[model samples]
Target: MSRFRYSFQKIVDLKTNEKTQAEWILSSAVNDLRVEEDQLSDLKHHKSEVQETLVSAAANRTTVSELMLYQKYLDHIDHQILNKNAAVRAAQINVEDKQSNLTAKMREEKVWSKAREKAKLHFTAALLKKDQEALDEMSVSRHKQPS
Candidate 1:
């Protein structure tokens, strides 16, 4: 029997490749989001520490000049935390977009794969029908032979 050849094998391969590439993209985006979140956490932790220091300074006989400096440093850290929070939000949005793209690619690949399977099934049936016809022809030929 002849080998079954898919006419759109290239398309199927391309679709599979696209899906793999999308997975990689989504993975990278997720990693970026994680980094952003870790940075945000670090900033929040630093802000808390600064607040503690400022409070401690207020309880001690700290110089007024030094107290002002602590307040300024606290303000700086608070600003940084705000900026980091924005960065984290942007990274989250990017991850969501990548996730959607990956989903779309997966769907396209599944469609092509299903089409290929159906084509293979049809090819198999045709091959079986042709073989049966050949066998029937041989049987008719044998029955017509002179006894």
Candidate 2:
């Protein structure tokens, strides 16, 4: 008996490769998003520390110039935080896009996998039928032989 071979094996291999590539891309995107979120968190933490310092300084006797400087620094931190927030949002969007692409690749791979399984089942059934026919012919000949 000949071995069963899937007709679309090449297509199945291509789909599997595509799914792997998509997974890699999605992982990279997720890492990027995590980095962006960490940056945003650090910025917020720094801003809070600066605010605490400004409040403590107000409790002591401070020069007008020094107060203005602290205020200016705080304003700069606010602007930086705003930019970091925007970056985090953009990273989130990129992550979502990568996830959708991965999903599409998974679906493509599944379709090919299902097709291969169906082909294997059909081949197996045909082989079984052929074997049964051969056995039936052998039985008929044996019965016709001399008792």
Candidate 3:
């Protein structure tokens, strides 16, 4: 019923809203990391299949010129696959790092959020007290009048 109590209630409500927002953001980051990891795994599998194809090509060679040309093409393809796979792995790692950073930020936000709520409640209480003191002084001056 007191002004301080009402102010503290409002502070609690605001903090709850902020916590819900933080949770939603963190959950989205986790989902993105999971999807990136899946893509990285698929890239690794593709690289293995490409290596197998090149090995088979080498074994089926007939003439020197034909074998050399076939090998050159396979080598080029293998190089490309290797580069692409590396990039996928790097991207996956970056996604994981982003997820971790988001988690840490969420925790820090929770801590700071509680402090923010407390400060808001305290400020409201101080304002209420100042207003009450002003009203009391006015009442005393009115009562001491020579009416």
lDDT of 3 by residue, 7-48 (tens): 355555665666666567667666766666666566667667
Give the deviation of candidate 3 from the true structure as CA RMSD: 8.3
In the range 1-147, model 2's lDDT, one tens digit per residue, is 989899889999999999999999999999999999999899899989988988888889988888889999999999999999999999999999999999999999999999999999999999999999999999999999999
lDDT of the structure predicted as candidate 3: 0.67
Q: What's the TM-score of each model vs. the native?
A: 0.93, 0.95, 0.47
Clashes of each: 0, 0, 0
lDDT of 2: 0.94
- In model 3, the Cα lDDT at residue 97 comes to 66
Ranking by TM-score: 2, 1, 3
* Candidate 3 lowest-lDDT run of ten: 1-10
In model 1, residue pairs whose N, Cα or C atoms come closer than 3 Å (at least 3 residues apart or on different chains), thus clashing, are none
Off by over 4 Å in 1: none
Runs of candidate 2 with Cα error greater than 4 angstroms are none
Model 2 lDDT, residue 57, Cα: 89
